[model samples]
Target: MKSNIKYKKTKLSTTTKIALYKTMLKPRLIEEKMLILLRQGKISKWFSGIGQEAISVGVTMAMQAEEYILPMHRNLGVFTTREIPLYRLFSQWQGKANGFTKGRDRSFHFGTQEFNIVGMISHLGPQFGVADGIALASKLKNKNQVTAVFTGEGGTSEGDIHEALNVASVWQLPVLFCIENNGYGLSTPTKEQYNCENLADRALGYGMESHIIDGNNILEVYTKISEITESIRKKPRPVLIEFKTFRMRGHEEASGTKYVPQDLMDQWAEKDPIENYRLHLLTEGVLTEKEDAIFKAEIKAEIDTHLDKTNAEEVIVSTESNELNDVYKDFEYQNIEESSNTNELRLIDAIHEGLKQSMEKHDDLVIMGQDIAEYGGVFKITDGFVEAFGKDRVRNTPICESAIIETAMGLSIAGIKSIVELQFSDFVTSGFNPVVNYLAKSHYRWNQNADVVLRMPCGAGVAAGPFHSQTNEAWFTKTPGLKVVYPAFPKDAKGLLATAINDPNPVLFFEHKALYRSIRQEVPTDYFTIPFGKAATLKQGTDITIIAYGQAVHWALNTLEKHKDISADVIDLRSLQPLDTETIYASTKKTGRVIILQEDSLFGGIASDISALIMENCFESLDAPVKRVASLETPIPFINHLEDQYLARDKFEDELLALLAY
Candidate 1:
């Protein structure tokens, strides 16, 4: 199955032409229905899959049911053909109840394993990672299912796409990557998008089998996709297919495409994929005008009925409310005797115990970081796990932060919930590219969770010095997709870590080394997982309030002893992402005076965010202006003495002075 723009130069049977024509007409009718729905004020927002239907319909229809389809935003054609009820599409477009994924999902962003559509991610090629993952899962399960991921020319630029490709090719994973080149990326033409004329050729770097095809021609597309998908399934290798076509419609419904050249639109519109395929079928003597008209009308009525059913649905439900339910199956937990009734299990011990338990329960749980395995991690948090779990489960990697995230992402794509450590929160800057561009936004961009866990020790107290310690939760506090957690107590350390491991979203677990072993408290040896967004209160008072997290929780606790008569309340923020302002407000409303303490530098830290939260939520409850105690904004000195002097060594004492003076 191969093709060239000049001509396919291959013979096709009349029956084959009829099947291709029918497949092409079905998607065209669907597109027409969606367009009509848009003008009727029923459909609001959507990215229409207008011109690339030939490839989408042909490849997906030719794919075996056991194999998987990981499509992109432009793959509604493929999904519609897979029997995803048109009502499901209409419900999703209108955010109505019949949508199946529930109203929580967006258009062209739904998937179902029952339909053999393993995953559909809209943020371009994030499906590459997911596609690789399903393939990995298939191999691990010894199943014969192959994974096919589709992306556009622009997606080839993302690191995640290449990363997935590299790993898939290296492992000879049963996967196919289809690149639909529509000649433009939001008006940025292919020349500006990449140096290569044909993006599939770039797959050579990863030893991937590559092909170039005429995407608008249904016959050519069907043969190529069938051939490539079959070859990968037989030999278990990765392949790349570049479909050359033009995007006749704008990037999306709301997109004006003002930047698209009128000349290109005129030329490409003349070669509309549906029309091209119709002519191809006719030239091959497949269907008469009467039969073609009847086929078009029949599909149009079917889509019209689907639209009626979808619009009649309530605006509340999704295609499947059970999406998050039982995504993991038969999880394995550590088989160990319960701890004896004893006070010896500290918070750090509890965290270790929890991770040990989780890894024992789920084979998909993986751990990796610098010195994590060989050295049991820089802080010894993961000590002795390498011997117990084996290197494949508890592994170590090189010092490259980008590579660490990339590999962990691949591991996540491989169906493992990887707990990747960055050693320190301050050093996360090295991996910021992947974290911000990929990990943090992967779920939001892909319209599905990636579930990669990033673990790092944070905070500046305990005199570890600047390079070794820092707290920068606010750096990503506002990022929408990533969950950041900075637990303050031993109990939270254990419970939060446990909860984080089970969450479907990527969690930035900032473990303060200063408190990892220093803070000791009773923790349940049992699986008493604490919720991720809740806050904890350590003490209650009336005159003033002190807010803190991580090492600052210790300082707040110690200050409580001296300020007992001052009527001060303290708050320990267990999770930074969903900051428990309700708890913070309850305490501040009682104390009236608010003060935030943080171990990070004064320039920009969680304290600033806390102050803003307090001012916004508890402004009128204040008897005085809110105050903060933070380390000075400077590099941490290597000397212990200099480091001590550099941070808020006597911050509590100074805070007390200011409170009493006020």
Candidate 2:
């Protein structure tokens, strides 16, 4: 460990030095009390940062209040340095109503915009990508703010950390990546985790400036961080700082420290950051023993007051009415007049029109995806977007789905609405962690709306096979906060996209590859939006009802037109989540028979849920058993002949005839 042996009097003022001392001391005292609570069985878990106070406090003290800080669970000094209320911290651990998450999340897993601190998720690596996004937001808005994110040496091994560093470097965003290299990742030593000698060497791979320093030296940590932050403010850059420290305790209170060698723990105890810094101040005459005693006494009294107050508070009880509240933003739909003048547009062109319209309306809106900037996307959906919106608003991301999704969450949390396009819908599975765990639950957990629109080009009709083709609407529809929208025609595509971009919740917008260029319609030139959960009745009849979305909707229309005798009501459910149950029941009651169709597989598909809903709500009105037509339960084959056989379109005619006969 390299140490700055001498601390200059001019480098840090007396006030700032004392403030850093107090900042480091608060977390040490707070965690000491928390460990006592853990032993008494009052607290469930305790993650101590006893030996890492210098790194967390030093890095955080350099950041401005407007800049963001995403902290790991063990970085208690970060909260203390940022001046977060001690009572609120106590309330959060006790699950009281006054907590950051209103008793929704336990411990340090809550973020508040007021403080510019994003709470850590249990999965720590994803927050690295999120910090990049928050930095991106600050850059796009010309805020000139720097974001600081902390993780341990264990986190550097995660793919998300690599993706985030690559993105921040490529984009030249202002982000400080701090690695608390605590010598162990829950008993796994540094040698077992990486092949390199120093973890900071990994930053060179991403074209970032790297530094290695003695983390136990408080003055050294603060001096280096302040200098890095000052340089980053002038010219945005991504920097990596590796603090070679040691974890003096177990991973958590429940996880015993037996795996750690007793000799190593004894060695680190002699170099305790707080005690070392305290002795240095005393030796240098910067502080007297009496002043040190006063500072310690003040911190202890403050913690005791908040602890008592938080313990006396009542726990929050969730009611049925508010339990589902904030899952989706429910605002009154405003009906806009459609233009008499119209333009003939293909489905792809209509989607482009929606994007242009949205960007023109909202200055804070941004579009991010792989190959979207210069290449204009694989399908040309975002062609000329960079020229129109500039590269700042229109971004080209690396082929990292997880980082792309997690970055969008960070931007959304920072109050910037974003639209992200997955080149292929099948790749959504790669980005499923943030979408399901973070994005889907943001609103419910903390009333945090990641107003992000995810555009997925889906379905199998283009002969693209399994890797590029998939309709995964069923996956998001089951998620509470996600709104799933699948449009069939060009006009519907344009209108629904406009609505989705303006929505205050996460929306999964599915665009069928087959329909992109094949489908054309006369769409209104003026801006228009179709309300979610309202089914459009295409062709009405009393004999049978065909309910479908995306490419299946067109298949139903084609089948009905071919057989004029089989008069049927074709209902297009534009949005799957807000199911349009009223229109569905009305159409099924009039027709007395129904057939639900989908391009996805049969079992556990969206059609299954619709069938169950029909049975529960309108079972008595059905004259015959409801039928479902969907693709075979297997991966889509590459051969065109096999693909054609696997699709539901070929089988739709027979299923419709069977339903008519019934």
Highest lDDT against the true fold, candidate: 2
CA lDDT, every model vs. true structure: 0.72, 0.87
Q: What is the TM-score of each candidate against the true structure?
A: 0.79, 0.97
RMSD to the true structure for each prediction, in A, is 5.6, 2.1
* 1-662: candidate 1 lDDT, tens digit per residue: 11122336556667766777787677777777777777777776656678888888888877886677878777776776687777666776777766545555577666664576644444555567667656766665676667777888988897667767776776577877888999888778899999975788798787778889888877778887777777666678888889888887778767767778899888777667777666655565566778889998888888878777865665573234244332222223322333444344555676677788778877768787778886887767789998899876776665556645655654565456878888887788877766666665544333335567788777665676666777777778777667788887766776677778887677888877767667777665665467766787777777777788877777777866775666667778889886888888888888788888877777677777788888898889888888878887787776777777776747667776687578
Model 2 agreement with the true structure over 432-501: per-residue lDDT tens digits: 9889888888777777888899999998877888898778888888888888999999999988998898
- Highest TM-score model number: 2
Model 1 lDDT at residue 99: 58
